[model samples]
Structure formats: C-alpha cells, structure tokens
Target: MADQLYLSLWFPNFRFEALPAALVSVLRQFALVSGEKRVTAASVYPISFTESPVYQRIYVNDDRAQSTEDSIIENAVAEATEQLHDDMAYEFEMKWNLWMPEGNDTPISEAALDTLWRPHPSTVKILGFGPHFDQATYEQNGHIRVDFGLDTPWVMDEEQEEVLDEEAQKHVQQNVEMLLAFTLSVEKNCGISSRLLWTESGEPLAEKLIARLQRLN
Candidate 1:
C-alpha cells in the first residue's frame, strides 16, 4: 500500500492563470475579513517549468484555506469529478492551489475573480503541442510541478503501529476518501479534469482505490 497518493487535475480548455497574482488577491481579501491591518502577501515562484516560459506557483504560509474547512478536500474532489463527467472528459493533473476567501464576497462573481489571473500564451502553446499533457515528452519539455499537501493528526510509530489494525485501517480509508473528494472539488470549481496516480507501484491497491471511489458514486 502507498503511504502517499498523487493525483493530477488538468484543465483542457483551462486558460493558464497567473496564480501568484490571484493568490495575492485571495489573501488580501482574507486580511480584510479577519480585520488584520497588515498588508497580506505571498511568495510566488515557478516550482515547475521554471526554466521554461511559464510560472506556476504561488506559495503561502497561512494555515487557513479559502473556504470552509470541514471535509473541504472531500467536497472539492466529489464536486470536481461530477463536473468533469458532466462536461469535458479529458484527463488532467492537479497542481494549482485553490482557496475561496471567507466573507460576504458572494455577489462578487467569477468574473471579478478573473481579474486576478492573466492568461499566458506561452503555456497555451506548450500544453497544446502534445497529445496528452501527462505524456513523458510533455512532462520533460514543460516540466512544471503543482504542489498540494494533505495534513492530518493521525500519526503512528512504525515500531508500534500495525497498518492492518482496525483503527489504522480506518484512518487510511479516511485519507483515501478525502483525496478523491479533493480532486472532485478541484475539477468542479476550476473547470479541470483529474486522475489519481499512486506513488507506490502496484495494481491491487490501485484497483481497490478505483473500486472504492466508484462505489462512492
């Protein structure tokens, strides 16, 4: 069994957005709501495809998410998958950071959010040049990485904890469900398609994962 799971959500018609700028906007909005007087900011870098023409990361130190935190990962994944199956069916990788600011910014509209992200023509060329963006050549030529991390409190010691034990098994199952849900939400909100790839090479676990997610629907 793999300890960590890797999933990708790629946007086919996704016009690449300047995520750093958008993140800055998001954080600024957060500050406004929290009543923090200091100017909020983020560290933007191109962790992937840096040498290339595109920049893809907007790093932040804040512990808060852009939306409600309860089962957020799950909701995002489920919603995203439903949206994808309903619309474009192409495969995708998830690398972007998504956060919905907290406030009564509701009537703001997606159009208003569009101002934060600018389209990059170079990324369009790079993505469209390949048949599937997940292919080896595309990954090499446009080597940009999107980073997302899942944090939980259920920690165990290798010397004492047996993974197959009932409690341990339950924790593992919860993580898997959260990953799937997060992927779905990304697709739903971002207009992207996603696929989950296991870091550990094996067929049985992968099959089991697919089965579980399918059963979820």
Candidate 2:
C-alpha cells in the first residue's frame, strides 16, 4: 500500500512574526531542488483545517503576465501571510516531477517495462503553521510541514505481486534519489533545527524503502 508522506521541519527559537521569511526560504529551496519556479497556489486557513481560508490565491493559469509577481516564492508568501496570526496555517502548492509507471492496470512484460516509466508532475504542499493553529499541531508536525501527497513514487505498489525488474528498479532508484535530494536541500538551506519524514500510517519510510530495495536486489 502507498501512504501519504510528509516532511516536518522545526526551527530553533522560532517566532510567529518570522514565518513569512521562513516560508519563502523553504519554497525557494524547493524551487532550487525541483526546478519548479512557480508556486501554483496559496491559502491561509484560520483556526484549523475545518475553517474556510481567510486568504487564498491561485497563480497557475495560461496568462503569464498576471501570475508573474504572485507566483514568485517571496511574493506568494508575503501575500498569504499578510494577515499573519498565531491561529492561521499558510499553505503553498508547487510541482515536482517523479518517475511513475504509465499504466498499472495492464501489466507489462520485462521487455516493455522500460517504455512505461516516465517523469510525471506531482503536487507538493509546503505548509507553515502558526503556534496556535489546529490546537498547536506544529508542536508535533513541526513549524513547517511538507505534504508529498503519496509515497507511490518511492515504494510503488508494495502489495502488487509483480516483482520489479532492472528497468523498474532503476526508475525507483531515481525517484528515491530525487526525494533524498529535495529533503537534504530543504534541511540545509531552510535553517531547520530538526526534521522528520513520516507516513500517515506511522510506518518509517526508510524501513519500507530498504525492504523494497532488498526485493529489487
């Protein structure tokens, strides 16, 4: 089974007023690592996830001129965090490419496996949490939480009976390297004091990746 993956980052002596700059740093790091320069969207949720956003902006569109300013990491963070408060959670969405199987329903033979792998764009959410938001979820989820949607690009379908071949293994390894590179870049460039990569099911991603690699071996 594939699970939702998240990277949580904590900063030492962090203050709510510093969130905008921190968010810009994190988003800029992501752009540097993933090569996706624009932030597609941003939203500010008040109090908790249940409440409607107090502020929202979408930069993705056909018109390049309109989104030019707002799509930039610094400007997007500034606009979203303009009304910053302890109970507001600011979220930004960006794209990252990952290797994925083209078709899963139809199983491919060894000879055709290589043709089915390609780089697919995936949505990555970078969220900055205020201290009082969601009853202080930041205490456990960290001041900044990166929601990487699904772990499929890393582990694929673990439940599938089909064993990965050399081509499949190669693609999987590429995805893993991309994930590692992004995480390492965020840790180094974002001035993070601590970080955690975890899954929705409470299972360690490293253990699962090790198991998958062993199978591939």
Let me know the TM-score candidate 1 reaches against the reference structure: 0.35
* C-alpha local distance difference test of each model: 0.30, 0.82
Candidate 1 residues 98-196, lDDT tens each? 222123232112213222322111100001112233333223222222222221111223322332344333433454554455445444554434443
**Per-residue alpha-carbon lDDT of model 2 for 1-217, expressed as tens digits?**
5689999999999998999988889888889889998899999999999999988888864565654866888888888887879998999999988776785433322225345677778899999999999999999999999999877778654544256667766877777777888888988888889999999999889676766667666
Model 1 is weakest, by summed lDDT over 10 consecutive residues, at 119-128
In angstroms, give how far residue 164 of model 1 lies from its true place: 2.9
Cα misplacement distance, residue 105 of candidate 2 (Å): 8.3
Provide C-alpha RMSD values for all models, in order.
16.8, 3.2
